[model samples]
Target chain A: MKRIIEVKNLYFGYEKNLVLEDVNLDIFEKDFLLIIGPNGGGKTTLLKLILGILKPWKGEINFYDDNISKKIGYVPQFSSFNKNFPISVFNMVLMGTIDSKNFIKKYKKEEIEKTKEILDKLDLYYIKDENINSLSGGLLQRVLIARSLVADPKVLLLDEPTASIDITSQLNLRDFLLELNKKITIVVVTHDPTSFAQIYDHIACVNRRLFYHGRGELDAQLLEKVYGCPVELLGHGIPHTLLKEHI
Target chain B: MLEVLSYKFMQNALMAAFLASIVCGIIGPFIVTRRLVFISGGISHISFGGLGIAYWLGINPLYGATAFSLAAATWIGFSKQDKMSESDLIIGILWAFGMAIGIIFIHLTPGYAPNLMTFLFGNILTVPRFDIFIISILVLVITLSVLIFYKGFVSVALDEEYSKARKLPVRSLNIGLLILIALSIVTLIQVVGIILVIALLTIPVAVAKEFSIHFKKIILISILFGISICLLGLFISYYIEFPSGASIVIIGSILLGVVKGVKKILKMKLNLDETIN
Candidate 1:
């Protein structure tokens, strides 16, 4: 498979405290990559480095032979936008056409139809006219996905897709992501162990360092090393295919 | 009310009030939605330094203020892009620096300071034809830019990171907004007075947000309702001998109070309906 992103000898941190050190990773096209780690383990930082939002302190991130930024779709975990802001779901999804060539141009008929299609696929078509603030967490997350995916980006990056949603919604999201992975490359940073058994193409364990990167059937010992704790059992809610308890 | 129009300055003031409400209507939602009230306050005061420079140079104070405010706005935008927390501190420092420059220049200017209260608290009734022309031009420019870039403004204000991911020129759009903000602040100085500009920028839109969930509707209601208050304040000041600028603000406060009361009633009604259901 051709590589879409390459990070070499990366080092990053906040002012005084170092977060990531000598990290390197390669992301291939059409690959579904899941990054899992304990809390405060620099998962988000590594993702930001990959997304080119935050600059790495020492190393470089290359995007398919170009240093100029690539158009990577993003679903942010914490938007900090006031939910009471006056935007309907349709308008919110219509914002996905930000990449339209004509800057400040009106949304085209095809763009509007495309937004509707994405919303329908996410099972959120019924609430297209409703206020965004009134949307439930599940619906909101799906709308966010629709917003990012409307651009038809080659790479889609989601930061904590299941952070605030309930277990049932998270499971439904897993089903949705599995379906979405058929088209574009997907990179996700999640702390939820319950989402571990979603059968990603590659699972990279991050803890201030790229400790393990391989298939989903990662042994219990490697999981323990990445988590810096004992993983004698797979998570209580995780699917049975996730672990064999070889710790 | 027809008799009041006999006076030319009263006509100018009313026109200024009308033009200003429109500009505020269009720009107000962006400021409030993005939580830039403090930054607006900072920009307006920073432009006062330009007024001081104009006074010293014997030039039109409005021109000086516009130039100064834009400079301050660009500086603030660059600083904010560099470091967000550090920018907050810089805003405070810039706020004082601009005002201090203005005050020192005013002291240095030869002759009486004239009625400085008009610049500080705004006596809209005394607006001249030149000021009205400036206000009209600003409203036109603001209206045109908003019409052309409505979606860009909405996306950038609502979620800049998302906008960035979509490959929107988030930085340029942000800087453009700050420029509009700078012009809005300069144009509004004569109506709301530099001291009360934030309330002028915010209160009407804040009231409108309660009644509508669409940007266009909010902007429309803000303009229409703000004009109603402007005329009402003019009449009240004419009859009761209250100051004009202060009166308009007072009416806004009363309306805000009424809006809160209505919100409470609506909430109670919603709860009642839920209980019955």
Candidate 2:
């Protein structure tokens, strides 16, 4: 597989304290890489650095000879969206195709057609003209995903893709992602290991540092190491941990 | 109507209202949608410092106000630290300082304040021909800029981070918006005065937002609302001997209440249908 992103000795901080330290990783093209970690583990920070939303204090991130910030499609956490905002699904998706230099021109016919196709592919064609504020959480998530796809990026970086949605929507999103991984690189930051186990080619457990980066199933031993507890895998691929001993 | 048009000052006031409303209508949606109403208020109040400085230096207060407000706008736009609350604190301090300076200049001016109440409460009847010309040109510039940069502006207004990820110039666009707001503040001062300017800038846009979903339509409706309110206010002030600025604002508030009330009724009806079915 071809290497699409390479990060070497990346370091970043907000103030006196460091958030991410001496991080190094390589992402291959068309690879579904799942980054798992607890809250405040710097996973979102790492994604921000890759998207060029924040600059690394030291080291560099290179994307296939171009700046990673320019080409990569980023789906931020849904919490960033204001529920009362009055944007439409079509306009929201059209935002993905916008760049700094082309501020003057309106959306072209080809771009509009492409947005329609992507919305249709995501089963969101019916909600194209609906105000984003009116949609349910699941439908909004699908719209955001469609927006990310409209950019036609080589890599799709999702920050907590299924954080706050229904189970059906979560499964639907996972299935859609599984299919999407066949065409482009997918990097998802999520805590749910069960649903993502089969889809991801590699899992990187992050906790202030990268604990492990390897392939294969997420066995109990690895979960224990990452979560500092014994994990039990229930039916339907849900993870339940036994804390009687700790208590 | 013909007799009213015969007076140059009345004609000038009408022209100023038309020009000011055009700029206000175009920029008003951005102010409301981006939740920058407070920032615009901060800028309007801060322009007082420029007014003071101009009075003290024997220069045009308009120039002073523009310079001060634009400077404050630039500072607010460029200071992108994580804590936005801290930035707002800084804006508050600047706003107070500007007001203080304006008062001091007024005190130092040799004349009997040159009818300061007119500038404070807006005497549209006294608007000059030159002010009308300036307002017209400004409206033209503002409208053209909005037309050319509609997509960028919309993207940034909708979501700044997403726009930045697409490599759009989010910082520059923000600064541009602030400058536009400063200009709008200066243009509006003659019609509504600084104290009531935000009401004129925000109320029509707020009403239009409840009725329209598209940006272009909102702009059109806001312009219509602003012009109609101004004309009605002028007529009422002329016949009833009332304050023009207050009259305009009162009419605008009533219109806003009616629109919001109607929208609520329609939404409730739709919800009733959904529940019943």
Candidate 3:
């Protein structure tokens, strides 16, 4: 597979406290990469660096054949949006269509038509006219996903896709993501490994540093190194026990 | 109310009210949704420095206010690290400093203070035709800008982090918003002085928010509400001893209180119905 991104000796931190240190990773074309890490283990930070939101203090993140901004679509964890905010579901998702230069121009007919198509594909066309504040957690997640996909991005990045979701919806969502994995690249930062157990192309573990546990059976030592503690691999398949912490 | 409208000053005040209400209506939802009420307050108070410098330099007071507020707001938005609280601290100092400069200049002015209370507490009855004409043009400019950049404003207001993720020039948009806030303050200070300028900008939108789920509705309701409050406050102030600026804000507060009370009663009634069912 062709490599799409190259991260070499990356170092990043916030004012005086270092977070990501000497990290390196490669994301290949059409790879559904799962980046799993403990809480506050720099998974989000790594993603931000890759998205070019936060500048790396040292080292470079190189994206092949295109700019990161034009190539990637992003879905944030929880947007602290006011429920009383006056925006329709259609308009909220339409915000993803704007870029730096063409903000003055209205969204074209074809672009808006494409947005509707994506909404329909995600089974969210029924609530397109509804106020965004009225959506439930699952529906909102789907809307955000549709928004990220509307631009036809080469790579889609989601931060904590399974957060606050019910088990049934999580299973449904994984199935949907598996379907999407065939068409485009996806990099998900999540702790819930079981949800993506059968769908993922490769599993990468991250702490302050990264350990790429290449695309095969995930061994125990890699999990131990990533979490900085001992862990157990109990089973596999749907709802697989990727790592059960030894208590 | 008819007799009040007969006078030239009252007519001018009414026109000022019309202009200020429209500008307030358009700008209010953005500031409220973005939760920049405090920043608008900071910018308004800083406009006081402009008033002071205008008096000291023998220039138009509103021009001084416009210059100072625009500078202060742009400076605050542009000169920033990541910490929001620190910027708020700087805004606080600038707010106080502007007021201090205004007071010192007003004290230094040679003549008999030129009725400083009008600028402080807003004597809308004393509004001149020139100020009325200028604010009208400003309202027109504001309306055009708002309509043209409606989507950009919506994106920035609703979800700033997500807008940032989309690479939407979040920094420029933020600074642009500050500039708009500054302009709105300059227009509003004549109708409601430094002490209550933010109230004029925000209170109508606050009530409107509960009723409207769309920005067009919010903006329309806020404008109507602002105009009604302005007219009612003018009439009430004519009869009562309360200052017009303070009275406008007081009326807005009472209306907000009433809205909250009604909402509470409706919620309780809904619960009662659910319980009965």
Candidate 4:
């Protein structure tokens, strides 16, 4: 497989506090990589660094042999989007296809037809014209995922893709992502292990540094090492215990 | 009504209200949805310094106000490195500094400035034919641009990070939005004045929001609401000898209250029905 992203000794910080330290990783084309860790483990920070939203204080991130400043599709945490924002589902997804380099270029007919096909695959064609504010959380998540997919990115980064939804929606999103992983290199920052159990080919645990990189089912010992505690996995695909106590 | 139309000044004021409200209507929803009311308010107030400088320099105050406000808008748009609160503080400082500069410019300008009150309180009644023509063309341009770039604007306003990730030129679009807002503020200053400009920008959109679920519909309704309030305010001022800007703001406030009250009552009734059913 072709190498899509290469991160070398990545160092980043917000003001005085250092967030990421000497991180090195290589993401191959169409790799389903899950980044899991405790809260404030700099998972989102790393994702931002890879997406070129924030420049690293040290080290470098390269996409397709180029500097990471090149654009990549990003599915941000649901909390970041204002629910009251007046936008339709179709328009939201259409945004993914917009070329920043050519601002004045209009969407071609072929692109619209392709977007419809993606929306249909996501089972979101019915809500194409629906107000985004009125959609259910599950529907909105699918729309966001579709939005990212429409960009046809070389690498797709999702920050906690299933953080605040119910069990069924979480499972549905997991299945959807698994299907998506077949096409693009997927980097998802998640806290829930079960949500990524069947989908992820490798797990990258981050706590200001890369702690582990391995294949197959997640090992509790490795998670404990990264989290610095005897963590317990709980029901409904969530991390219930951190440091042997409920958290 | 016929007599009102007979006067050219009245005709110009009416045309200005129509054109300005159209601009406000189209752009207002974006501002309200993005929760950039404070920023817009800051820009409008700061433009006073530009207006004052123009008066001091014996030039067209509109040109100075537009230039100063556009500069402030650009600064606000590009200063993303700072936290939101810190950025807001910067905008606030500019706002006050702009006003101070305007006041000093007025002080520096020689002779009695009889028409200065017109800029401060809005002289819609004395709007020149050329000013009316300029406002109409600007409103047309603004409306057309919004239509052409509706999707880009919606995405950026809704979620800028996602927009950028999708390679949507988020920064440039943001700057475009700010520039449009600066132009709107400069144009509307003649209709409602700077003091009540924010009120005009926010109130119609706020009221329309309660009634419409879609952005496009909200904009259309906001234009209707804005035009209605302006005309109502004009009539009230004509009849009761009240200040035009104050009267328009009062009309907008009343409409906002009515919309909020009606929405609350309808929501309560729906809840009651659900409980009984």
Candidate 5:
């Protein structure tokens, strides 16, 4: 597979305090990359650096493709937005088509058509006219996904896509993402890796440090090395019993 | 009411109110959605420092307010950091500091500031033709800006991080929005005075949000609400001989209360009907 992005010796921090140090990773075409870590382990910061939202203090992030900004789609946490703000699903998704070049212009016909197509593909067309504030956490998650996909990105980065949704919605979103991964590279930054188990091609455990694994399953030894503890299980709320016994 | 229009002053006041409503309504939804009410309040108050300085200089106070407001808006917007507390602290300092500057300058000015009350608690009935012209220009600028940058404004207001990730001009949009907001605050000063300007910018949008679930709709409804409230307050102030700014705010607050109360009762009724069925 062709390499899509490369992070080399990355160092980042907020003010004087450091968060991510000497981080390096390679994202390839159509790779399902799952980044997991404990809370405040610089997982989201890494995603932001890749997306160019935050600048790296040291080192470099190289994108192989030109126009990487337009090529990469981002889905932030569902709770990131103001819940009371007035916005329709269609309008919200339509905003995805807007880039820096079209800052002062109105939406074009093609962009509007593309937004509709994305909503339909996500099974959200029927509720396109509905207010976003009226949506359930799960449905809102899907709408956010639809918004990101409307831009026709080559690589999609999701920050905690399944953070607060229900089990059924989580499973449905996993399947949808799996289907999408067939078409484009998918990178998900999640603290709970078990939520998307058996789906990721590679797992990168991060805790101020990053330990990358090629296989889908991470053994207890590797988990301890990353998390700095014996890992018997990894999931949100419920125990997954997925890890092997630590020797 | 028709007799009031016969007078030239009354006509200018009405025109001022109409134009003010248009601009305020146009920009109010953004202020509401972005939760910039505090920042706007800070900007409005800071303009008073300009007003005071302008008085000391024996120049047009509006010019001073306009200059001070724009500067404060830009400074506050650019200086804002990631932490909410830090930004809030900045706003708080600027808010009182501006007012203090205004007070000190006015005190230093040799004579009594005859039009001081007009700047503090607006007298809409006394609005001059010059102020009306300025307001009309502002209305035009604000309407055109909103129309042109509607998508960018909405995107940045909703999610700055996501907009930045999309390579959208987040900084430019934010500064642009702040500039428009500062202009709106300056225009509103003649109608509501610096002390009550935030109310005129917010109350209509607050009420309009109750009726619409779309940004464009909220803006349209806010304009309508603002115009109605301003006119009604004008009429009431004319008859009852009350402070126009205070009257306007009172009417707006009452309308907001009524809308919220009525919606609550209707919701309760629906719940009862559902339970009975």
Candidate 6:
């Protein structure tokens, strides 16, 4: 696999508080990477740094792709923006087609066609004209995904995609992501690993520091170190006993 | 009402209302959707300080207001952070601080005091033709900008971070929109004044959202609603001798309440019919 992005000695903070420190990671093309951490463990901040939304206080993020802007897509947290905003499903997805070059110009025919294609693929075509405010949590989440997919990004970064959806929606999203991983790279920041169990090729536990584990079994000490407690992992096709009883 | 249109001042007032409505209609939804109502209020109040300074300097109060509001808008935009409560506190302080400054400066002015009530309560009948000319220019500029950058503005308004990820110059777009909002507030001040400017900026959009889900349609509807409200309020104030700004806001509030109530009743009737089946 070819490396696509490199994070070397990254340090970031807000005001006086340090959020992420001395972090390093390598993301390859077509890699399915899951970044797991406890609440407020800088998961979302890390994603923001990679997406160039936040500047790192002391480190460099190197992107190998010359056209990084067009090659990377981001799906922010479901609760990041107000869902009560008066916008339709079709228009919301269509906004994904805008970029630095074409923002002042009108939408082209191909861009609208691409948006429709993505909506169809996500099974959201029927409700294309529906107001986003009237959609359920799961459907809204799917809309966010569909919006990102319309950009045709080589590397897709999602922050807590399964944070608030139902179990069925979570499973469906997981399967959809798995199918997408076949064609492009995916980096997901999620605290809940159970939903994406036994699928990610690489797992990076983050808590100020990062512990990267490649394919195979994960060490219980690594989970304990990142989470500051013994975590129980329950899923098929994985180790039955994840950690010692929390005593 | 027909006889009133024959007066030159009444014609000017009507022209100002129509122009101001176009601006409010275009800018209001962005303010409402982005939840910037409070920030817009802060800018409006801060402009009062400019008005006071202009009174002291014997300059156009509208010019002073434009400069102050644009400054405040830029400051607020750049100072915005991820923590909303912190930003809210800053805006709240500026809002009060601005009013205090305006009052103090107006007190220090060394001439017969300008009628402060006109600036506070607004008299649309007294709107000069020059101010109408200014508002017309504002309406044209706002319309053209929205026409070209509608999608970009919508993207930033909907999700700032996502827009940034797409390399949409999120910071510049945000600052640009804030600047336009400042200009809108300053221009509308003639029709509604500082005390009631935010209501003029937001109320029409609130009512229009009830009629449409599409963003552009809502904007179009809001413009029409704004024009009608301004005209109605002007006529009501004429007959009752009430303050024009307050009358406009009062009419807008009642309209909103009536629309919401009717929608609720219709929804309940539909549910009842479904149960009967």
- Candidate 5: residue A55 lDDT (0-100): 92
Whole-model lDDT for model 4 versus the true structure?
0.79
lDDT of every model, 2 decimals: 0.80, 0.80, 0.81, 0.79, 0.86, 0.85
Tens digits of per-residue lDDT, candidate 3, A53-161, equal 7889999988885665576888877654555577777877777787666676788998799888898899988898888877888888888888888888888898998
Tell me the tens digit of each residue's lDDT in model 4 across B1-277. Answer: 6797788877887888888789779999988998889899889989999999888888878889889889988988888435777988888888888888988889889989876677777756767898777777777777777877777888778887766555677787888898889889988999888877888888989988887777888999999999998888777766676777888888899879987998899999999999999
Worst 10 residues of 1 chain B by lDDT: B160-169
Per prediction, the TM-score for chain B is 0.95, 0.94, 0.95, 0.95, 0.97, 0.96
Fnat, 2 decimals, each candidate: 0.48, 0.59, 0.51, 0.49, 0.79, 0.73
Error of 3 at B95 (Å): 2.2
TM-score for chain A as predicted in candidate 2: 0.85
> Judged by lDDT relative to the true structure, which candidate is superior, 2 or 3?
3
Q: Judged by TM-score relative to the true structure, which candidate is superior, 2 or 4?
A: 2
Clashing pairs in 4: none
- TM-scores vs. true structure, each candidate: 0.90, 0.92, 0.90, 0.87, 0.93, 0.92
Q: Of models 1 and 5, which has the larger lDDT?
A: 5
For residue A52, model 2's alpha carbon misses the true position, in angstroms, by: 0.7
Model 3 quality (TM-score)? 0.90
Which prediction has the highest TM-score against the true structure? Answer: 5
- Candidate 5, residues B1-277: lDDT per residue as tens digits? 5787899988988897888898878898899889899999999999999999998999878889999999987887687746668989888998999999999999899977677788888989989888788778888998999999988898888888888998887887888899999999888999989999999999999898889788888888888888898998888888998999889989999999999999999999999999999
Lowest lDDT sum, 10 consecutive residues, model 1 chain A, at A228-237
If the candidates were sorted by their DockQ against the true structure, best first, what order would they fall in?
Answer: 5, 6, 2, 3, 1, 4
The residue-level lDDT of candidate 1 at B137 comes to 93
True contacts kept of 5: 0.79
lDDT per residue as tens, model 5, A137-189: 99999989898888899999999988889989988989998999999999999
Query: How big is the positional error of residue B220 in model 6, measured in Å on the Cα after superposition?
Result: 0.9
DockQ, all candidates in order: 0.47, 0.57, 0.51, 0.44, 0.70, 0.65
Tens digit per residue, CA lDDT, model 6, A106-203: 88999999999999999999999999888888998999988888889999998998888999999899999999999999999998877776578787
Which tens-of-lDDT digit does each residue in B162-187 have in candidate 3? 66666788788778778878888888
